[model samples]
Target chain A: MRNYQEILDTLIDVSKHPLRQVKEFKARTGHKAIGCFPEYVPSELVYAAGMFPVGLWGGSVENSRAKEYVPAFCCYVLMSDLEYGLNGTYKDIDAVIIPSLCDTLKCLGQNFKVAVPSIKHIQFTYPQMRKIEAGVTFLESEYGRVLAALEEICGTKVTDKAISEAINVFNDNRRALRRFVGLASEHTDVITPVIRHAVIKSGFFMEKPQHTALVNELCDALSALPVSKKGKRVLLTGIMADDDAMLNILTDNGLAIAVDDLAQETRQFRYDVPSEGGSAMHRLAMWWQIFEGCSLAYDPEKKRIDMILEDVDKYDAKGVIVCMMKFCDPEEYDYPLLKDALEKKGVPCLYMEIDQKAEAQAQTRIQAFSEIL
Target chain B: MYTIGIDIGSTACKAVALKDGKEIVGSSIIQTGTGTSGPGRVYEDVFKAAGLMPEGVSRIVVTGYGRLTFEKADNQISELSCHAKGVHFLMPQARTIIDIGGQDAKALKLSPAGTLTGFVMNDKCAAGTGRFLDVMAKILEVDVGELAELSSRSTERISISNVCTVFAESEVISQLAAGKKREDIAAGIHMSVANRVAGLARRVGIEPDVVLTGGVAQNLGVIRAMSEILEMNILPAPMPQLTGALGAAIFAYDEAIKLK
Candidate 1:
């Protein structure tokens, strides 16, 4: 059996080179890979269609051709995604699934069609009012459309049993991740911020069941050891906190991420599809309804703020770090209210803007935050 | 025991030596910082001024941009915490602090007990910083130190609409070409910086008994404009630029005490 460090090293390598993962997986498994864009795109359908589901969270690439398609004000993630597609970095991707979680994503999907005509584009809009029956029904139909698109790309009919199996695989991965993150908080000396992020992000590149097995083994290995003393525990809330430079600053300041509301990390695995409710597509739609505490998912009461506050108390976090994604409208709109809520509750919060193209300058602010903690 | 604190900022390096954590023994400020040899020079200058050998110092704490790079320091602390400690030592009643450095502007909220409770900073922009004033001074053909005097003599208020340093430089050149008086343009530049800094201060929710500490605080014109914009009297700290260094020294003293 592999040790936890060995497992962690593999995850980190997979995260650092996702393109390599995709190529190796395709070559090994003889499978087509479908690219899924940020926030949410149902990858289970692609898995059911017998294809690899690759996550296209924007990378650290220079923007040149994408400039023609997107305005300079677009968020770095979408801009880089477009740049990758335009520059043929995602040429191996058979079909790209784009969700209209925000305005920039909508433009990205449209631009992907025109700019990267070599690859296929599949676009879907998530319902903002996901709590009600109408929203569920609408999303179920949308999932049907996505399933149809994936089936067309792979030239295979997706059976309900395959999707159910795929859902089981994904649910197992989520459960493994939930356990790993909890165990990670207790073993931060081993799982630094970067390691924690890599462990979670590597799930995006690997087959779900394989990732699940590795995470479960790692969690068991961690559970065998004694819980380490807590350091300066901090809760991170944002669209994402995967940047190496920012994560290095957190580690340098001796801050351990006790929990996170990051859309890319915890947000992806926090909710599972109901095993016994309606059809497989209906179950996926229900998963959307159950999903709370996301800026993209509209909630009138802003339950995300309350959830964050609770996480801070539960995890004994000294403060909260708001990794604001630059030009991200949904996250930007939610920040002021979140700040107000955290302040009223007497929780210290630091807001740091995460821009892929911008230089790293969060050192002073994060250091000061650590001092106060 | 003598504790030393050094702050290597973007454009200035400051050092302060404290005796037994209560009394200031010596302080020095050098106008160069960061990429230059300012850190080494300030370290030597502070010990010389204090009439103490480096070996006799109980602890050395560094702050600001160059803190990480300076190898001689025993400990490193953030400028924000150091500023809070320094300000609280000087004036315990201060609840809010606005610090404008070479390339960044920050607003810090303090508790009644002088603990730093909250803070906000400008994001990778030089518009609200000391560099903004330097650029304006160079374009206007005057020394940066003379900006306050020049702005005070202005009879009219000219507005600089652009807050971006590059665009604002172009705007300033346009005003000069259009034959606007240098004093009015200088006054406009101060207001622009004041407005930018005030925006950051408002984000952190400025409280009463507000104090300003930084190299930029030495400019009386900026203080006047900031006071008007914030709608509150802004007190400039005595030896404003030394606050970060003093705070570092205080931290060093505390660290030494803990060791003992």
Candidate 2:
């Protein structure tokens, strides 16, 4: 019998039969599918609704077809979706939920609804300001409404118990995920490239049983592995940055991404306290705090300064790489403030902007930035 | 017999009525928006101040931030394209246009024949724009409008380094700490913005006869500083702030004729 680690490694090594594997998994499962972007996509809630939550990465840069449809200054999210839709990769999607995190995203959703007539799309206009009590109440209602709609579509009951169970599963999975990230930071030899790939795939894609198995294997493998060299651990700030190849770019230049303070990842997931115990809205309050807590969500330069310091110290990081997306006005506005804060605190940071069309310029800059780091 | 253009800026509305599209019949500048009221109310006040009837105008074009809010506009054009068109109309030989407004600034490069080639805008940051100068001027206890003339008269341009508005504000305080002359620092700030705008134009290749429009164009100091940086003559059109409205009016006239 294959070990859990071996199973994950096989799932990750998709060059041989990725489509066949995905098709097989889809065929066996009778789960409802929900598509979501990085921001405000609560996968745990989706799982509670008895639906499969697929984290949409938009599309690949190799597909030049997206360039013709969207302008150079438009958000990469729109272009990626267009590419994904036109390329027939998203044919199996039942519904896509978009968050109005920015003007570009708002416009992108409207246009996407028009372009893809077949898919059911819903836009959630999130409040820009997150701190006040009024904002949290608004968000809780919106979350409740979205869950109800999701239940109607999936034909499943999303009881508070189910939500609690889903949260526990996710919390367990997060522990496993943290172990993998820690393993990467430690540069353990046993956590091979293949295993890492398997870990990410299973962590992001798998629902319950498969997800648990994958996590267990990952944790076990990580526990057994010896720590490698102490390198410049970096926390990536700004934009949902998977597509820009920043990880490959950084790792190639002797920089290891120990963690990401992305709006999509750690920022959206709050510490789930029982909603009924003390305040009856503790979880909702925590959710709003999570958004406010994230440095990426707003122009909290001091918060970013503090978060960067915390991440750097925790990961033994040498510096930070602010990965800005082109035409991202908010990040651009905050970059200087963060830069000042970082500089004053004696932590070095570099600002690099990238679009979907990764070019030679990005490569050269990454090389230079790494040397400086 | 005359075409009218109205530019409802953040602080004021500048109206220019031109006879035969070349001669200025009446031009009036007034405080904009009437203390948070819409431009429509302010427009009525401006027309009354000019002693002109609403029907006396053959065609009207509105532009600026409040352009869309105006109900009587024949055509509404983007400030970027309008600034370019307005500059091109004034200085036909001009190849580059730089318009610095309250919230944003744009550097536009026009083809020899007055068509847009390329442009760069600073909408993300308050630095290197009119807003920066305004804040600095307030700190200096002077009107923002006067900084242009005062800076131009300075013997030399000083350096106000730092791109972030927050940092730049601190930088200004530091300059004060160092006992630097206020006029020289003001001149330096203009030079800094001019440098940024010039750099943007240089990316697309700057041409001769660079026209400066928008509210900042009224500042002769910045224009001179920009000219010094580009090593080219900086031409200011008559009623530069109204250029967007003028360009919009031109488009409106053309559209009306096409319909006829």
Candidate 3:
């Protein structure tokens, strides 16, 4: 128990101060580090290029400087990333890889390129028709483009075998993360929502292998405990739900997160990159093809709600709580429809806006939802 | 046994004491003060009015933005659920409830039994809330309480379309400089708030017997504008601001009965 607490506490500290982790990783490994934006990016390629891929999900920062480049209507995640770029917060990093997954991100790439000329910016647009063979071809081209940009920074040739090895390591990390999420739901008393988020989020900063090992140990420790009856079982959905304030509120209200469809968490790892394909680049592109039912990705039938219901039944959740990030239109567009679909089937739900800053009202919303359950 | 429910809102605090879970024996509304101590102040005021002390209450359920901060609350509920329940109790026919409070605007769908079936809330912006009305009233040099009457007297309607409170204030300043009439702009501000809230209500599918609760429901101008925009008669709760407190009181009564 002492050993597990030490390991989890260290990882949570790393999540709290990301720049410290970046400096430590650079000093410890003597390897170069680069930044990768959230939702989906070809981090495996960066790993193959002999550099750590630091995930940038934009922490709680009061930034008005980003408004000079982007509108206030843009999501805080994108705006905060832009703010970090302009404010020299990420100046120590070599380069940044921005994926044009949504409209805000698409525009962010251009703004970063024009505004921050010091850091090299690599941008790529994922194929919208990602379920077809041609989509596979398109993704391969995109990965190849990013790979070339990475090679220029690493000053090393990224061979197919290097990428293949990187894929195995990342696949291990993903599997371990999925395992921890499942284990944490049963032992929420030990793994609290904030700790669960920290353990998952710390994976973004650490090397893929070390992260998996720590989580794999945490999972082993938690597997021995009986199911915790500390909180109500509920599923979370939306862009990102790592807001510590909201997590604490859930803890106070006795709401245990049974599962989630958040872009920053399970949505990123719900599948793995197929190891066998034309090349490592093609396999990297294939991850996008297998992805579906996310607000960021295009799903013509809009089947996200059905997938959420599946989690609800699987986790035996009483209801769903959507931590809708403020100013995110893509997620906003889906809420009414998702609510209608869930309620028609007798599933209950609560909607609370997750802004960058915490407010008492958001806490009340969570408390009320839990009270009803 | 008497049960109590208290709601500490952003701008005001309201509480209700119920007898036998069906009658409102005592109720009080007061402006919110600083910190986690506001709910207790309103609770005392209500208890005195009800001719009962804290010992007489069997259960206490608190709801609203400041709910968790209330130290004496036995249970905490959400303003959305509370409003839905309060409206259902006030008007049984209400299937949809729209609440515009100090800093939020929400649309909640309720079953006939008053359970929250579906709902939606504005995303951290104050354009459609009571705070926006207060700011607009400040700009128009009229009391916030009187602007509702002034808005109703406008001869020609003006439109204020910005959905951000800060930007809307600037737009109002520009309109004032542009020689727009105060009554017209006041009417436009109410219409803008109405239009924004009406959008949220429609998304939740506004059914007949739509009830309005919270502080903004007291403004006749917003209710009139919403009635025009939604093309349905808007039913205001008897004491709109107290509905959340009343709902909490109902929950307290239910909890006490279950314990028995």
CAPRI grade, predicted model 3: medium
The model with the greatest DockQ is: 1
Model 1 CA lDDT for position A144: 93
Supply fnat for every model shown. Answer: 0.90, 0.00, 0.67
* Second chain alone, TM-score for each candidate: 0.99, 0.86, 0.97
How do these models rank on DockQ, best leading?
Answer: 1, 3, 2
**Residue clash pairs of candidate 3:** A368-B78
Judged by TM-score, which candidate is best?
1
| Candidate 2 C-alpha lDDT tens digits along A161-261 | 78767766766766656666666667623443333434554445556556666666756765565677444556777765554255555555566666656
DockQ, computed on Cα atoms, for candidate 2:
0.01
lDDT of 3 by residue, A120-180 (tens): 9999988889888999898899888999999999898999999999999999999999999
Q: Superpose all Cα atoms of candidate 1 onto the true structure and report the RMSD in Å to 1 decimal.
A: 1.2
Cα lDDT of model 3 by residue, B53-158, tens digit? 8788899998887776687878877877778777787888989999998888888888878788777777667889999999999999999999889998899888
Candidate 3 structure, TM-score to reference: 0.91
Q: Rank the candidates by TM-score, best first.
A: 1, 3, 2
- The list of candidate 3 runs beyond 4 A from truth reads A1-3, B31-41, B166-185
Query: By descending lDDT, how would the candidates be arranged?
Result: 1, 3, 2
